[model samples]
Target: MNKLRLRVQILFTILTNGYVYGFLKGKIYQGPLKYTCVPGLNCYSCPGAAFSCPIGALQALLNREGFHVPFAVLGFFFLFGSLLGRFVCGWLCPFGLVQDLLHKIPLFRKLKRLPLHHILKFGKYAVLFFLVFIGSVFLFGGFAKIPAFCKYLCPSGTLFGALPLLTANPLLRSQTGGLFGWKLGILVLILFLSIIVYRPFCQYLCPLGAIYGLFNRFSLLQIHWDEDLCTSCAACENACPLSLTVQEISRSPECIRCGKCVKACPVSCLHFTAKSNGYSTKHQTCVPPGTNTV
Candidate 1:
């Protein structure tokens, strides 16, 4: 409801769904250089994508024969995850934006807050393990087959990435099998759940988001609070998409850098800050405060 929340949401909408605007006008930006990384999980197979998706690249590496762990891909993931954490999910991911919009439907019931929320958060790790470790390593005899993540589990790849590609390539569609059907089913189930719950992928799945969340507590970009200036109104906590209790610690791994808390703080008690080498430099607000201390 605050200016910061509005700005963050608007920025996210623009970045993720900008392709819709371009597509309507019959203009698509397709260049080889767009294959480069710009952070967040934008589907490379999306007809309008200018850059490659990190998860796609990772899966490709894992699926390649004699998989050696592509340093470039891993480096990109680490750089983006460490720098912004799940800020990407909150303000950049196209899929994340899709879930947010679906949650706006009036018929849906918001999830009951549960202890299982904390437990289910670990599901992404299991996905990463099964897809990356067991599926790629054990089943394929060391990544010699198709990307297990894309084939079996990745709803993003199934919905936004692969479906569009299959639609455009009839030859590709001819090759569809039980695996594709399985992934499609998973995608459909997740899509249905999105309308009923908020960010099912972000909360229960999405290994990339899970990885980035690990860095949210210590990322270069972070939310800062001064208890001295604090009012324990719990406004920030209520506003958080991840259901984080902001007063306790704004830097929790689950804290998506959405800036909702910053906007929700009536006294402006919450701020964005950059921390490095144990020194902190505060920025007045979260959405591009213009002071580049980092």
Candidate 2:
């Protein structure tokens, strides 16, 4: 599954970022297809990006002068969120692939738990609410729409958009200032942190991940836990990249559905399924660690 997911990630990344001409020439793809938003948090400002980012599109809609409902962008969120949840984060996001690859590097000791991990996880939600949702709507600079998250904080924009655009366009390069340096510093910090933390951005910063995560339990596709599997060993929880107790969470919001826990399960119980919460009991409760009561 890991290998298959890796292939899919690579293929999807290439498909979404297919415009080699744009990359070479440092121009955003202005084709008709660019209007379509992909499920992943890809930067549309990326010269090679063939599709718009969902987050970027959402911000654009909200950033407009009038406060009309962003039905189109909201529909995009609901459609994808209901269908796949944060599975897009695990298998589709270009930045996700970058972090996955970085975490695979053996240079540093990977740390899953931090002193304030539980508190830190809420950061993404704050980003979604404050920067993307609220900031985009109200914090405009004159008539221009300000995508607050992308313009200020998105590492994807800095890495895939601004960097390449500046590199190829001398005009853009000449206009670089302190804001560029700040964003570049953020990118560098995330890249460095990715070496030791698995998906630090998605876990704690990405507004898109926060939005998609809300649909995890409600999504059509989910990690199903078989209650009849006999022992509740907590092995799957140990294997979880996000340190979520897979057996108990019943499709945890933070779960990207990476299937690492499924692979590591001693009892072959957890698997991907479209069926909703098929466990015998209606109430999904956490079986204590080191217990076989489940």
Compose the digit string of candidate 2's lDDT tens values, residues 61-144.
887778878898889889999999999999999999999999899987889855598899899999998888878887546645
Q: lDDT (0-100) at residue 35 of candidate 2?
A: 74
* Count of clashes, each model: 1, 0
Query: Where does candidate 1 stray beyond 4 Å?
Result: 1-31, 112-115, 140-144, 247-249, 276-280, 283-294
Give the residue spans of candidate 2 off by over 4 A. Answer: 140-145, 248-250, 276-294
- At residue 292, candidate 2 shows an lDDT of 57
Q: Which candidate's lDDT is highest?
A: 2
RMSD to the hidden true structure, all candidates: 5.3, 5.3
User: Candidate 1 on 1-294: residue-level lDDT in tens?
Assistant: 345544666675455435663344334456675657656666666655667777777776666667576787779878887787777777777777667777777775676232488788788888777775567654753535656776677787676666766766667779999988898898888877877777888778887777787878767776778665788899888877667786544466666677778878888878777775644464333326566745
Q: lDDT of each prediction vs. the true structure?
A: 0.70, 0.85
Clashing pairs in 1: 34-50
Candidate 1 lDDT at 224 equals: 77
TM-score of 2: 0.91
Estimate TM-scores for all models.
0.80, 0.91
